[model samples]
Target: MSIHRLIVKSAALLTAGIAIGALLAGAAAAQQKLSFLAAEYSAKTLPFWEQVVADFEAANPDIDVTLEVVGWNTIHDLTAQRIAAGTMPDLVNTATIWVPEWVDAAAIRPLGDDLVDATLRADFVPALFDKGAVYNGENWGLPIAAAARAILLNKGLLAQAGFDPDAPIATWDDYRSIIVGVKEKTGAFGYAFDAKGVRAFRDFGYYLLNNGGTFFAADGRAAFNSPEGVEALQFLVDLVKAGAVPDPLGTTLEDYQPMYEAGRVATMINGNFAIAGIKANAPGLEIAVAAVPVKTAGQTPVTWGVTDTLVIGKAAPVEASRKFIAHIFSTAVRNQFDEAEGMLPVLLSQAGNPAFTGDPNIKAFIDMLPTSQFDPFHPQYAQMQELVKTAMQSAITGAASPKDALDKAAADFNALVK
Candidate 1:
């Protein structure tokens, strides 16, 4: 073998090695595709999600993303079916209320410091990230929007009832008086309550929180059976007994909409989403939105301000999903998505963006983020809501005392958590 023969062999081997490496890299890139099943965006024209995907793909050409928007009503069924089949999407815009249960079911993975750096954590509203996304002390997802339930009161009714339209309702006693006054002056139900079903839990939840109580105690025991809980339920029962609020054993807000529209309901409690609906139902109706009245004076305002969260499934490629999470949450994309969805921006700096500032109703909800508390993130949350409803109805219908009804609910809650 001469020097020329050796040199030709070495060059041929090097060229083959380079070509093989390129082929491997292209194959790896092709395999880096992510499937995201989301709700709400799947049907929108010019969806903000599509824009986010396009921007992400532009910045990251090597990764492919598939977005499937499922309808809000059907997404839960789809998620359950997919999870049962072990075919959950790589990323899912999880039903915020169910994220904890998903974590418990081993459907999603808990994100760690490696995947969520300080900068990424800091990008979201601190309280939202801290309250809405954490489950059992672990950060399990990211909240994309923030909204809270507030009180919508008709100023005209307040004035007619000899109450100052500008004065905010602060205590249960005062709220009761207003309810009575409205009934006396206008002969209309002062409060339109949705107390007939599971949603009844939320209507009473206002009283529970304002009284400085929680569903579960620090020891992980069901504690709403305590005095605070009794006070809350007793108040509702008293209202129904006094005929200030009609029997609300199985009704929901939609049922009360007609009453609200007819000017027969003085105050209704609901979330930011209700503003547009109320306007559409009665375009001439004038109302004021404020933090729900507290159980007592001098208590800090509190309401369940929820955020829509996206979580990565356990079967998803963690690295790719993480990169997508980071990309989708970039300030530009986040602000735009929130604006289009009529949601508050997750970032603190965007608090004053005219996009959010222009809507006073949304602003009231946004200003509440600081004082809001996310509902308990537990697998038993739905059951808990039902149990609370049963207890409330039993008390309101005179089937049991407040303490007795709540005691039974505590037993049920304890059994579920057990």
Candidate 2:
């Protein structure tokens, strides 16, 4: 009853403890963990994703999800660092234009029937899903958010400029007259011209596309130096020279957004998401939403439709990641995310949801979807965009004429494509 019994009991307890520890470790190893790198859409973005992660974890106890939200400006660099470090996230949200590069690098996996079933693929808005998420004839991603550009007019400034606050600007001539009138009468910038950074190409695109110009021709050659492109660039340059916009050489959309919200800018071209920002920042400011006026009457209105995509990394735990992707792409989740971020829904099922249909600002963007054109999703398109930005800055600063600047850009773009 003394030494022998004590030693046996001690050994038995030690064996039990080890067995329990091994079982616990195995259980922990059985749970799948996934990492998500989301590009920040707004202040609400992180919080919304946090809630989604919480809900997903609660519903799927066997899967663990971690969310990291980075600003749009830094996501690309951060993602590249993660890839180089061999620690890529299971899922990532990136600008749709960047998909081609990621595909070219083989950094992401294609979402085939195994990941995205036919039913799920069919639910996405065709224009967005087909054009934005497809690369090299494969579905590479899903559109996380979509937006279409439109013009926002300050009604008070329009009235001050002796134009009907509710009148539609039907042609470029009418729009130009209002731009000059607003500056002359109110001494406020008539149009907010963003001529710096990546967005400069977007600004130029509005004019170029509306004027029947395109980034590439039918043969996939650079066509931005065509007469239509030159005319559009000249229009913007002329506006800059006439004092219709402020500091076109130095300003960007981020700089002008606040000025517009403060009612110091008369008009600006912005995505439908701007309505939410304007409402939040300047609740009392009266605003009017209008189509970007055509180059001439009857030319048909065009808008830029942009989408940010959600992709799965090649190194991801495919089963767990696919389950999560399907969960988020469901109609209810998609609607909530789009509403919170003030983005147009990428899901066709959510297009007619009351939350979107009830808002005129959202309706306007939806209406423009028919005539919307997206950026070229080429591997070198980012470089081409930078070249275009350089030309825009040169033209705006009077360092070169619009035609000359664009001609040089076109040459560089052709070389890049070749």
Candidate 3:
């Protein structure tokens, strides 16, 4: 070869070698490191989570995932705080109510409309994916677990009241009569609610919806303080006055747990988590779960349905994070993870799978899903909770009429949004 040709060939070889080395280095650098934040209950189901995570990592050997266990009470605040501090995990599990807030803050990254598969999205119930995941016209998170406010009754207690425990409690009037009969005959309070805790507000939300009242308007204005809301609040107050529930002045969610376990309360209107707690505390007791009864005949039954979503943090690598999220919702993982935690699975396929259907009691949550009321997809959710909490405490404590209290709460909530 001529000297010039030799020189040109040598240079080309050097350039190709450099390009190959750079490609290898870039590939290595693309290996992702991710962490997920979840509650202790889910942490206890770590083995199931591990199987799911291991499958994902095995499929994508370049990724490493770490699970961080968060305490339930602080997870919401912790998620927001870390995101605000610019130290958010790659993925975090949070309540549905937090989705809109995080989306507004730009703390959560969307799946990008192009990446969301139409078939997969269609597999999700429209009402759920639309109302539960979408906020301000954006999808913020994917649901993993579902929760709903339902009535948990002691089957033995109802039988003692001369009613079949397996029979559905269809109306508030029927439930009330049974409660009074149980109270009169057995000398036990027939119902128990978190009369003093933030949960007190949830009952009003559930019952108001049960009575055909909307909790919030499409514009996010308070709509629950209407006649239905007032009537629901009065019913709760009456339960307290009639000695069906413990003193409204001195009851918390924690208080009701033990009371129900000890058989002091014949029925409880609480979240699905109560199932696990009840089983742990009173293993031998016969218990049944039912949807919140309708307020009057011909009214469609409704309940407070809640969910926790897994959101990819804005700081996460988009493509890899999306894959991990998709894996988490895979049929095998969602079925095992949700049932292990005593929660409803978000995947439509697993929603009523035989594995979850073993317990007939849990059917109430599944049955109510079509009509359940979701918390408003408001960006000001945390603030709205505060407003509702204050009004609820005031009404439950008898410091203000339910109408005045809820009306003021609505005003305050609207003001915060404005």
Best by lDDT: 2
Worst 10 residues of 2 by lDDT: 215-224
lDDT of 2 by residue, 371-414 (tens): 99887767777777898899988888788899999999988888
Q: Pick the candidate with the highest TM-score.
A: 2
TM-score, ranked from best to worst: 2, 3, 1
Q: What TM-score would each prediction reach against the true structure?
A: 0.83, 0.93, 0.86
> What lDDT tens digits, residue by residue, belong to model 3 across residues 1-418?
9999999999999999999999988987888888888765644565766777888999999887887777778888888788778888888878888787788778888866444566666666566676777776777777767777788889888888787777788888888887888899888788876645656667667678889887678777778788998888888877777877787557887887788889888988877766876888799888888778889889988778887777778888767776787687677777777667788767677755875677766776677677777776767766666676677778877899888988898888888776
Measured on C-alpha atoms, candidate 1 has an lDDT of 0.80
lDDT of each: 0.80, 0.86, 0.77
Backbone clashes counted, model 2? 0
Candidate 1, residue 271: Cα displacement in angstroms equals 1.5
Residues 1-418, candidate 1: write the lDDT tens digits: 9999999999999999999999998788676889998778323424777878888888887788998887766777798888899898988886688897788779988877656677888867778787776877787888866668888888788888888766777788888999989998889889978777546888878888888878888766788888999998888888888888766975677688678877889888877756666777788877787677778788777877767788888878867787898887877777777665656688776766887788767777777777888877667777878888889888987899999999999997888786
Per-model RMSD to reference = 7.0, 2.5, 6.4
Residue range with the least summed lDDT across 10 consecutive positions in model 1: 39-48
Q: Which ten residues in a row have the lowest lDDT in candidate 3?
A: 111-120
Residue 31, model 3: lDDT of 80
